[model samples]
Each structure stands twice: as C-alpha cells, then as structure tokens.
Target: MPRIPFVIPLLLSLLGLAACSPPPTLDQQLYIWQRQWRPAHVEALAQTRLDFSTLRVLALQAHPKAGWARAYPDLQLLKRDGRPLVAVVRLDGQLPQLDPRAIGEQITSLLHDWQAAGIQLAGLEIDHDCATARLPAYAALLQDLRRQLPAELKLSITALPAWLASDQLEPLLASVDSSVLQVHAVSDPRRGLFDAEQAQHWAAEYAARSPSPFLLALPAYGVALLDSPAGAPRVEGEAPLRQGGTRRELQADPQHVASLLAELRDDPPPGLSGIIWFRLPLAGDRRAWPIDTLLAVVRGQPLRPALDLHAQQNGQLSELQLVNRGNLASALPAHIELPAQGCTAADGLGAYRVTSTPQGLRFTRQHPGQLAAGSQRALGWARCTQIDQGGLHVEL
Candidate 1:
C-alpha cells in the first residue's frame, strides 16, 4: 500500500507553531515609534521586562500610549508611571518654510505643559534628513527652547548619517544638546552598512568638531528589504543570522559582537564617553541569545581576552583571529593589519592580509575568503611592507 504524504500537514503544523510561539521578552530601554509599535506587541514586550526591577523601560513615545494607565487620561499628554520618554513629532516634509521663533515657542510650550503634568523627558527628538538643513534657523529655536527648558532635560536632534558632513555640522550641532547619529543603512540601496559605516565615520568627523555628544545609532531595525547586489555591507539588524540584508529574523551574533567588544576592551579610545545601543526590545530571539554580552560591556564588566591578533611566523599574509573568549556576544571589524606590513610591536599585531582560524588562532585571510565566527584560514600573497616595528594597535 502507498504511504500517506506528510508535506501538507507538516506545513500546516509549522504555520500553527509560528502563530502560537510566544513573543520574546523586552529588556532593553524601550521606545515607541507608535507608527510601528503595535498595542499587543507593546504589552507583550512591556509585560516581560516590567518585573525586572533592575531594568527601566523608557518609552520614546512618538504617539502617546493608548489607555496607558487607567488612572491617567489617555493621550492626556502626561506621564504614565514614572519613566521619562522622548516625545517624537512625525513630520513628512510638507512645510515650505518654518518660522523659527514661532515654531520654537510652540514646541517649547507644549513640552512645558507635558513637563508640568509630571511627565519626565530625556529631550525632544527630531527625525529628519537633508531637509534638516533648516537647522541653522532651527538653532535659534533650540537656543530659546534650551533657555526655557528645565536644566535637567537634555536636548536631542537626529540626522541621517549619509548626508551629515563638516559644512552642515556646525548648524545642526548648535541646535541641540545631544545628537543621535542615525546610521540609516536603508537609505543607500547599493550597499547597506558600508554606507552606514561611511556615515558613522563621517559623522564622527563632523561630531568631533561639533559641540554636541553624538550617540552612534546603529540600525537596531533590519533592512526593510534587500535590494542590492553581492558584497554589500553586513545585513542591517545584527550579524550572522541577518547577513546580506535579511530582516525581522535578525540576531546579534554572539561571536561577532564579542570580537568587537574584545577589541574595545583591549584598546579604548580616549575621550570617548560610552556606547549606547539603538534599543531594548524582545530581541525576538527564541534561542535567548546572550544580551549580557552587551550589558557586560556597558557596565565596564571585565571580559576575557579570547581573540588574539598576531603576525604570522610564516611571514606570508597571516590570518587575524577575531575570537570570543567571553560568555557574552560582541562585534568587531575583521581587521587586516595597518596598511604597513612587517611591523610587530611588543603587542602581537601586524598590518595587511591577516586573519584568524575557528579555534581563535591567527592565520591568513585571503582575497576571496572570509573569517566567520570560529574558524581561520590563509588568503592572498604576503609581500613585506617597508615599516616593521612596534606592537599591533588595538582598542580595548
């Protein structure tokens, strides 16, 4: 007798499981774009982290919570519970010219009223792009707003990383107390994170000259869709699982994130303040990925030195080790040594065509090869560069 086919039922079973699977817990500092925040999703995420007294959920509320608290009027423009939230106004362009002083007064008064209602605020977060050039006049607005604002409330402004530059820097900087350097990876369809990284580098340059402290806003959200060709920047959300621009199912690869943190642990930049993540959400991870990887970094928690970068004894192009010794996850650029080759300092590092193996040992990275997670191999021809002395430069 012929056996019954199993594919149809199996597919239905998976669909049911997908529907029934419980949403993950939300533990990060919570914010709401309202446009994207679903009521149930909000409740699901909020309820999960609420019991953990160690964590505080701050809502960056763009749209007020619907019936947030029974005691408070819904959309009353007041605080619910006790956390401070950023009130984000949605502007889809459309304005021909904004009167700087008038607009400033209007927002300031509304914010004051919100403050009076016992609502705390980090600051007003504005989201706009190249059009934000109106910021010089807007700076005048912020100046007045800043003068009137409660001293404790900080100011914030958001700008797309792609277009931010030295010329536009001063005007935007003058407008706010802080900067959210949005690595808007999606705006560039050709290459996502490459553009994003370029944005960050340029932002860092402009930010260095500006007066405001800018938080690099890496995309916590995934790429809306993958529209580019091969060899684009690492996928938007997290590494590994989301590589090549896959969305929603993104994850912060523990190994990748861990490597980056290790470098920072090894070599920290002077005058750098602190690293802020784009969000605190359910993480939507069923496997319960290590959030502590980032938490440990944030707390200045000590981590072990797992991934070691060393010059190969072979003298050919050596593989660089991007390893994860800590229990938590981190991220790092698969660094080739400084362009100058044949340089080995007291510290074990070299420049050019370097790589590491899966066992966390140094090897050679090739022109056509890659070092992912726990593995290493050699790549390309190793020609000796002129300069040869000094330890490898690392950021811990």
Candidate 2:
C-alpha cells in the first residue's frame, strides 16, 4: 500500500479525537411552585421522571404581613417517585430584615417534618429577591443557614441576575454549594418574559462569579399582563386576577429556548451544572407549555405544529373538536367549516361562534386562544342528517 501523506494522517487523527470527545454533561431539574397540591401532580411527576433528575419544590413562603405559610404539597406523591428533592423557601422581597437564626430554625423544622414524611431531600434552596445592596447581609444569612443545615443536605440560592452587578455576589455564592440563576421575567413586564441573548449573557457572567456549580432557571410558562390604573400592570399567572383591562399575553417560546440550550450545550460555560425549568406544567394549567412541548425542548427535538379537525358522531349529532397532534402549541384557527345538509341545529362553543352558510356551518374565532400540544378542544356541535366529515376545513 502507498504511504499516507503527512497532512492526511494528521487530519484523520484529529477527526478520531473529535469523535472520541464526549458531550458536555448538563443535569435537568424542575421547580414545583404550586402552593397547594392537586390531583394533576401525580401525572405530571410521573411524566417528568425520565427527563428531570431532581425537583426543587416550593415548601415554605415567608411574607411580611402573613409571616410563614407552608405549602400544602402532596408528600406521598412526591416521595413515591424517589427523585432527590430540594425544598425551596421563598422570602418575600419586601422583607425589611433577616433574622438568620430564626429563619434557619424554621427551615430546619420544615426539613425535619419532610424527612419524617419520607421525602428524599437533597438540598435547601433559598429564593430571596433582596436588593443588590443587601448582598453582604444575604451572604451572612446563607452562612448561618449552611451551618444549621444537615451535613448531607446541600444549600443553594435562587440568585438574581441583578446580583451580577454587586461585588459581594462572589461571597454570596460562596456560602452555598450551588446557585440557580433565574433568567426569566427579570425585566419590565412590557418587554416580555424571556430574552435568549440576555439570558446567555447573564449565564456567562454568573458562571464567572459563582465559585460553585450553578443551574439556569428558564421559564416554561406564560403570564398575562392586565393594564391597571395603578402604575404597574397586574400579572395573571396560574390564576386569574379580579382586575380587568386590555390583556397582553407573554410566553417564552420553546424553539427560542431550545436554540439557547443547544448553544449552551455546544460551548457550556464554566461552573454551569444544568438547567432547572420553572414550574412544571400541570393539567388544566392555562399559562404553561404542554408537558410534551417542554419535553421536546429539553430533548432538543424539532417543534412542529399539527392542528386538525375531528368530528365525533353519534346518530344525527356530531361533536366538532379541534385537535393539536404535534409537539408544539398552536394558535386556534381563525375559522373552521364543516359541510352539511339538512342541518337542524348548530352552535359554536368556547372561543368560537357559529354562523349558517350556504354550503355548511362556519365556526369563526371570537377571541384569540392557544391549543396546547397534544390537546383537543370542542369547537362546536352540529346535528345534521347529512354531515360530511371528509369536507372539514380549517383556516389557521
């Protein structure tokens, strides 16, 4: 055989090295922030087991006026999965001061209660939105909490991007085993929920300052901003607010976030351990991405929207439903038409209105709405002697 040229052999060696290099390791976790447990959590927890290795649950919240309120999470459901859990204690940003010892005692008591209930706790995460000026004081509090926590339990903090501006941030992070830098809803509500570029910049800066490994908390949910007479817009999250005004909905796009994840995975920042998704999506959660959509983003799969019309028939009655059969959430179609003859009655349901047409019944969208991935909604009902299922039409 002819001897290989020097450049060819060198190129082959480089390719071989590249092929042998293992991809970066990034752990995925979830935040369960519901104040009260629901029956839906059982299914949500089961679906997330394979993709998410840990769960950071909101266990206690401390408010200025209300004092402390423990979250009513279903302990049995949480413990059944056997995934490592992190109890998140939220201290209201308006809190005037910090009594490290007292707060530490409260956390320890809650930990004991959870342990007795058979929860496999791996850590405690302090979620406090203290001002940048308070970093030194916050660091001191973490130090005290660290000393108080059980040796096996890791201590972490939900760090703010604003903290990057403070010189004391390094010390604050030093007090904990790790930190989670929240990159969503940190700016003006009018600007929207998440900015991929801004998030990447924050991650890079955080990775530089953090002495220990840290995770990035990204949004998997949406919120409505209702204009109020007050200076600030009222935010509607999982629950609706009594106040009414022109609503502007903001959601973090799954494709945008998926692209960001790809960038991070390709060139991961130092001390960046993983991603922790904000609030796991639950059934009947109007403001969250469908669980399937979130999973697709996590797995770096393509996002595709598939919306179709399905008619369920029983005798002369037909239930018209819009089904989203893709891994991406889709906006409701503007109009849906079903060809029919000798129709006795037809009416739209939900965000649609029906009108009788020459050839069929037209279902026009009355209000804007989203049909989550892998979900179906009843569009309307029609009772006709001759309804054509094959003639169904939809305008997106």
Candidate 3:
C-alpha cells in the first residue's frame, strides 16, 4: 500500500509545530566600564550573577592626549564566580591615525598580562568609533589584531549604526567573530539618549547587514548634559565634570526598554544573539537604574512602585521617613499630612515645606525628587501629644 498520503499529513503537522515553537532565548551580558573597581562591585556582581551570563570589561582605553590608560579592575572579584569574561580595548574616535601593528602588539601584551594574573578571558573586543569613511582602514586594523590574537580567543568589535551606509561595513564585520551594535546615545544629544523605535529599526537593519552573531548594547543608565559655550555639551556619566552651563538630565525609561525587550524576544531578528547592557549599575552609581529595577525588567517581571511612610517615635519626638518598597523607583509624594493634636514642634526636611495646622501637620513638596527602590528618605520630625499613624495621608 502507498504511504504518500500519511507522509504528507505528517510533514504538514511537523511544519505547523515548528511554526508555533517559541523563538530562542536571548542571552544577557553586561559591560563593566568602570575603570576603578571598588568594594561595592562585590555586591553588584553578586546581584547580577543570575541574569547576566557574561561580562565585557573595560581593560584599556587609548586617549588622544593621555595616550593609553589601563583600568585597575579587581581581578579577584571578576574571577571569583568563573563567568566568561571579555576584555575590551577602547580607542578614542578623536585620534587622527592608528598604527595597526602597534595597537595589535599592545592588545596582545595586555592579554598575556591578564592571563598571567589568572584571569580567564573568553574573547577580546575593540571599541573604536571610527568614521564611516575610515571603515576600510578600521577593518585592516581589526584584521591585523585578529592575527595577533590567540587562535582560541574570539575577536569582536563595537560597531556603530552610522557605518550601515558604508560599503565597507560587510568587510568590517567579516574581520571579527562577533559585533556589538550600540543603540543608545548614538544620535544627536539634543534629541535624547535613546529612541526605542529608532533602536528597533537599527537592530533589524544591522541583523540584515551582519553575517556574524551580534548583540544590542542597550542603555541601563543615564547622563547629564552640561551646556558648553565652546561646542557640544559635555556628557557626564558615573561622575560629574566641572560645573558648566545649564544642565539637563537624560535617563532611559525602564518601562519603554522592557517593552522593546519583550518585542524582540517574541520575534528576534536573524543572527541576533543577545543584549549587552551599557553598564552594570552599582549602589553608588547615581545616574544608573536601581539594581532591583534593572533585574525586574530583564526578567520581564511586572514593575510596581510602592512607597511607605514610617514614623519612628522616641518619647515625644517622631522621625518621619518615606521608604520605597517596590521594584520601581517612585517620585516623592507632593503632600503628606499627619493628623495630630497639641503638637509642640513640627518641621519638614529636604524639599518639603512644613505647615503646622490646627488639626495636623502638613508637609508640601517644594521640589521634585525620586526615591529609588529599596531606598528610604527622611521627611521630617514631629512632636505631638496625640498623633494618629492611621490617619497619615500622602498625595503623590
């Protein structure tokens, strides 16, 4: 008996199943760009261990004037967990020319030194913001560097979206094992730091152009643009520069980024491997997102801001505090009212204005402020004969 009919139905069913199957999970990595590693990195690394599979650390940076500066990262901290690590070497875009052999030699020497220090490196990444016209030369540099590197170690490059228009893009990509397409802060600073729509478009375009596997470098942090009289605004990230003209702060919204991530996960571009966050946020890093907030977004968990008011009483004195208990950071409430009677003294702290009313004490916000997740802020203190915690009112 002929079995063609049965085989056709079976093949159709298999195709249907394949079509409905979920896309592959995108791996998440992090860039530890901090040149100086501190004790706080210990906690930061531990917190992100489950989410980030690899670490792309800044090992060395070449400056136009200062020449070359090596990062003093804590080797013990990075090697403790045995995670796959990639050493990144940055070449300033302002440089006039690059000696391919000299640069390659320096990188090779750096790799040897790191290996001697017992640091296991999985790959090497060259971060050079070369102009589109100079891509051919950039490719030559990468090719030379690749030859100098050990055959076992993978070589990658941080690619720019502007290079898409150049005919040399394909060859530039071909010179490396992988590429990291940076989608944040690639546009005019006056416009903003990140545009989700534009980023998605770039990612799709990059996937079409890149033959090798690639990752999207999304921003998990923010920057302050200090106005300069001379030219472009000076960007301040991680630390503040010398005081300048009016300042504007730009931050990447977690909700927007999470939505984008969900869209990509549902239907990822071809050859798109994963995401490498621009930075791993530390406790002291003010411009970056809170660790909890970043983790929640990466895990696709719901983001909810929870603010709680606490009044610690010692005799007649009460210390008022506001605590953010949820995974999302929240703005400080605009008004806080505490019903009280026979209050001898009451005062507001920080950006709040205190008003002692006949019925209670009212604290009105004088300025805007954000309370980070798992952080608490002191509001004010009050001394009253009768105060009701149940009647505490807050207006956000």
Taking the tens digit of each residue's C-alpha lDDT, what string does model 1 give over 1-396?
987679988999999998887543222233333233334444434443432222122322222223111111223322343444566543323455444465555566666666677766666665544354565655565576677667877777665544443365677577677765555443544433324335435554645565755554433233333434554433333223433544323333433433443443343322223333444433442223334443543444664434434346444444334444454433343443334444342223333244433222232222222123233332223334332223334333
Please report how far candidate 1 places residue 386 from its true position, in Å.
67
**Number of backbone clashes in candidate 1:** 35
TM-scores for all candidates: the values are: 0.45, 0.91, 0.96
10 residues in a row with least lDDT, candidate 2? 238-247
Model 2 Cα lDDT, one tens digit per residue, 1-396 = 998799998999999999889767799999999998989999999999999999999999999999999998999888888998999999998999998877988898998899899887889899999999998998989887888888888988999999898899988888889999999999989898999999999999888888898999999999999998877888899978888568898999999999999999888899898999997999999889899999999998999988887888999999988899999988999988888998889999999999989998999999988888999999999999887877878898
Question: Can you tell me which runs of candidate 3 are displaced by over 4 Å?
Answer: 1-4
Which predicted model would earn the best TM-score? 3
Q: Which digits, one per residue and each the tens of the lDDT, describe model 3 over residues 190-235? A: 8899999899999999999999999999888989899888788888
- Model 1 lowest lDDT segment of ten: 65-74
Each prediction's Cα lDDT score? 0.43, 0.91, 0.90
Ranking by TM-score: 3, 2, 1
